[model samples]
Each structure stands twice: as C-alpha cells, then as structure tokens.
Target: MKHHDLEILITTRKFFACDAESTEEAVKIATTEARKHLGQDFYSLEIRDPSAGWPETVHEATNPEIT
Candidate 1:
C-alpha cells in the first residue's frame, strides 16, 4: 500500500494520546465523546515515545520505502 501523510486532528482522548492505528480510527473512536467536547483542544499526532516510528512505513508516490 502507498503511504499517506494524513493530517490528524485529535481532541484529547486516551487512544489517540497513546495508541491508534490511524487518524480516521482515532476520530472514529472519539466521535461519540467528541459530540460533547466539540470545541475542546486538539493536537497533531507526534512521536513522543521512543519505540515509535512513522505510524507505518510504505512506498508512496513521491516517497520511497523507509526501510
């Protein structure tokens, strides 16, 4: 599969803050709770932990495979 640089918008929650496969997944998980905290705060996903690497690695159009 091709790698996609998805811009994820996260409204503070545990999964997105710790573990999530993708932005869409994170949003889906939060959608129910998000209804209550619509205007809360948000953050872009980042590499905070050492064991992390780019969310996933794959060759995409302009980008080559990381490995």
Candidate 2:
C-alpha cells in the first residue's frame, strides 16, 4: 500500500496567551490542544504566524491529491 503525507492547519479566532517561550512551542501546544478537541485522525500539522495583533491567523493543510 502506498502512503501519503497529510497536513493540518489550525487558526485561532483571537490572540490567546500562552506560556510557551517560542512560536514553535506555542504551535505545539495549540496543535495538541486542537487535536484533542477535534477528536479526529490526522497526520501532520503546520502552524502559521499571527499578523501583528491580528486575531486572524492563516493555517494550511496539504495532502495527496486524489484523481
């Protein structure tokens, strides 16, 4: 069987405070929390940087294209 990589994107509605020291840490925490909340099967996750003070953050998911 062939395997493909999956990507997941999570965006927050507002700027939330996090105890993480860096963006990577923050993303990891957010991803974990989101996964638990989502309760679904996923492969990989990517976190996007927030716009200066902007609540809207862009997240992207990539997966194998089906024909």
Candidate topping lDDT: 2
Model 1, span 1-67: residue lDDT tens: 9998866544442332525797555445445443454443332222222235645522111112221
**Clash pairs (backbone) in predicted model 1:** none
Q: How far is candidate 1 from the true structure (C-alpha RMSD, Å)?
A: 14.2
lDDT of model 2 at residue 32? 64
The whole-model C-alpha lDDT of candidate 2 against the native structure comes to 0.55
Instruction: Provide the overall lDDT of each model, using Cα atoms, as 2-decimal numbers.
Output: 0.38, 0.55
lDDT, candidate 2, 1-67, per-residue tens:
9999976556444334678897667776777666565444444445556653544444544333421
Q: Model 1: runs farther than 4 Å from truth?
A: 1-18, 36-67
Q: Looking at candidate 2, what is the lDDT of residue 46?
A: 51
